[model samples]
Target chain A: MNLNVYLHAFTGVVKREFWRFIQQRSRFLSALVRPLLWLVVFAAGFRAALGVAIIPPYATYITYETYIAPGLCCMILLFNGMQSSLSMVYDREMGSMKVLLMSPVPRSWLLISKLLAIALISLVQVYAFLAIAWLAGVEPPALGLITALPALVLVALLLGSIGLFLSARIRQLENFAGVMNFVIFPMFFLSSALYPLWKMRESSEWLYWICQYNPFTHAVELVRFALYQQLNLQALAITLGTTLVFATLAVISFNPERTVRAAPAKA
Target chain B: MTIALQIDRVSHQYGQRVALDNVSIGLVEGQFNALLGPNGAGKSTLFALLTRLYRVQQGEIRLGDDSINRNPRALLARLGVVFQQSTLDLDLTVMQNLEYHGALHGLSTREIRRRAAEELEWLGLADRTKDKVRSLNGGHRRRVEIARALLHRPDILLLDEASAGLDVASRQAINKAVRQLCQERGLTVLWATHLLEEISLDDPVVILHRGRVLAEGIGRDVCERSDETSLDALFDRLTSAKEAHA
Candidate 1:
């Protein structure tokens, strides 16, 4: 409730996350490598079979790499989101969560600060990936980077909130790595991250409808449109709405009043 | 003298099992009150409620004039804690850990650095500020934790089994330091431990067993009342009755 305290803690939380991100060189490398692999190696193979339509975000046919770039960018956010939650589980196990949990700052503020930190870190990886994509001959509109920053941030918040909600709700949280794999693979493979919904519709109406409904698909579409200097209003509404929903769920689940266990470690 | 902390008939349960059964305690300012109990005597549970990590399901807990459920942030603002578990981020340097904790309490950056340096110097740990917490020994880690606890200038210090895993010398040193803190700072302390050796004969002691308080008085008084010679003997007599009864 204290603004000074809230702002100070917010800065500290973000700095700590940045320190953790930079300190673990391997984690940074892996976050970039996954998206790059899809952009460079996997995109080459899929380029022939997957033909992206001249969708609203696209005025004409685009190369598979160019088309999947936004999706892959969002892929970085998704992985980073899951990674943030995994570290939270690690914090719980290590007892490092005590300082944050016992703080006088409201639990909601603490969580929002953490989510913002995670989102900011995710931006780091997304930009790194975008730079690599540009070097590989997949150039988005130069102004698109500036315009996409806020959209990317919104998507980052959305994904991180989902991750936070999962971190709090999942009971078998010790197996969070397994949980991550299960969630990341399905959410990515099922959504429009890898292929277009229009293309998926040609294969099955059910999958097309599923992709349309997936919040992640909207997140990708938001980034995809923003990268081309276009605003996808439907994507904006879906992403913003989903962000609020998960953020609410995340805060509620992590609320201390709702937690009766002596320590979350035991729970 | 103001009551620094009070638990009014607080009770907690884990499913159908009672964790704390109508436990209560009244502690005045600057008092180093020891919560003496065997394992599973609800020592940790009591600390949880005090720290608001676990909400009070029944009765009320007050810090100064603010009841826990009434204005938790106000109560939390004046509270410091050393949990049974180590809460220091091991990957972070000692100063980083302290600074982060300071920030949590709404300390300005300048204030955080100044107070952190002061507290570390007081704890004799100014030289090791940049060392990663994982690099420090258990005793030094504990010292850093204690220093972090005081960074917020809290009126109450709740150490839940703070000396649980230390060697005898380390335990004695830390215990001595905490005792000194209570005197010098006028900070009320609720020290929870199962170790009878940790409590001085003159210190206020709350002996709890099986989620219930068995004795509530000065250690010497409890020993005298039970016709026991020392705290260790008094503890044995009180807790061993189940074996005799069985």
Candidate 2:
């Protein structure tokens, strides 16, 4: 009821998440390693095959690696968001989630706090990825890096909310592997992460439309524009709208009462 | 005796199967009460409802005159719970676990430190405060959970099978510790278990069978009313009779 109480609870949840993240050294390493591999190895191989036009975010011709850097950054957020949801499932199975849900703070705020924690952690990894890319000679303007912070946070929340919505619907940890295959792969591949929508349109009209409608595409574009010291109003509006929708669904589905109904009956 | 917690006409069903059917009970303030039931007798379901892990489907639960449905936050703030499973973060130290619980209840840092010291000392875990929970034995881990549960100084302590999966000595140790809290701190305790040996004749007991309350009263009175001399006999007879009738 009191502001101090909510503040204390928020601090507690975020601190526990950070502590857990710290202890899981492999998780941190993998979070960074996944995108770095794509940026360094995959992009290098594809540089000759894929050609990028002067997109709105790109003022001139850019190499494939440079073009995919923003997409790779969004990839980190996307994966971390799903990873955070996976941890929520783990927590639910392991009973630690009960300790969280049982707190007197409102469940909606607790969930948002959780998403915020994931977003904060994802930001650290994104910046690390950007730094690594910068060292690899993919440097954006210094001010652009500063400008991208808010945009990155927004995309992280947008992706995290989608993940939270999925986590709420997912019954067991085992089913998550299927979700990764079904959801993560399609979202990543269908988006403009690897290639531009115009490239997809040249290949197949339907694929182009799918990429255009994919929320992840907008998320990537938002980050791409922000990293170039520009704002894409259309991408910003779509990303914000999708984030709100998914966050609302996540909160509703994660209601303790609804979750009980969703749980399989046990003896 | 004051009833610190009240469950009124609560019913729950999972699809077509009834988990609890029109169940109701009042827990005595400042006493060790037992909710004794078999594996599928809806004990966990009741615990779920009480903790608000599941919504109350058909009845109301009141904690010290506040309806849980109307003011769940207020009621939950006064209730401390140790679930059937261990809820401790194994990677964290004993003190860290307690500190997390204290913060969830919105306790100030100074207050958390003071209570953590007192509770851990009382639970004989003062020396192990710095040890990660994963390093502790089963008994010690349960003790840490108990310590964490009491860190907020809640009026009522609900332990749903808190002694499950521990050695006999560990179980007895936890049982004694909670009983002491009832006597010394006037903290109402609801200890749910299927193990009959954990119930003493003088303890308040509720026997649930097949989603219904078979009997409830002081352990001695419930046994006497059923014309049984021991709790084991009374439990078997009551549950078996329900099984036959069904």
C-alpha lDDT score of every prediction, in listed order? 0.86, 0.88
Report how far off residue A133 is in candidate 2 (Å): 1.2
Q: On a 0 to 1 TM-score scale, where does candidate 2 land against the true structure? A: 0.96
Interface RMSD of 1: 2.9
- Place model 2 in a CAPRI quality band: medium
**Candidate 2 pairs with clashing backbones:** none
List the pairs of residues colliding in candidate 1: none
lDDT of 2 by residue, B1-246 (tens): 788899999999887888889999999988899999988788888888888898888999998768889998888888889888788999988887887788888987778889999988999988998899999999999888888888877889999888999999999999999999998999999999999999999999999988899898999998889899999999999998888999
lDDT of 2 by residue, A128-155 (tens): 8899899988988889999999999999
Instruction: Give candidate 2's error at residue A191 in angstroms.
Output: 1.6
TM-score of each: 0.96, 0.96
Give each prediction's DockQ, rounded to 2 decimals.
Answer: 0.59, 0.64
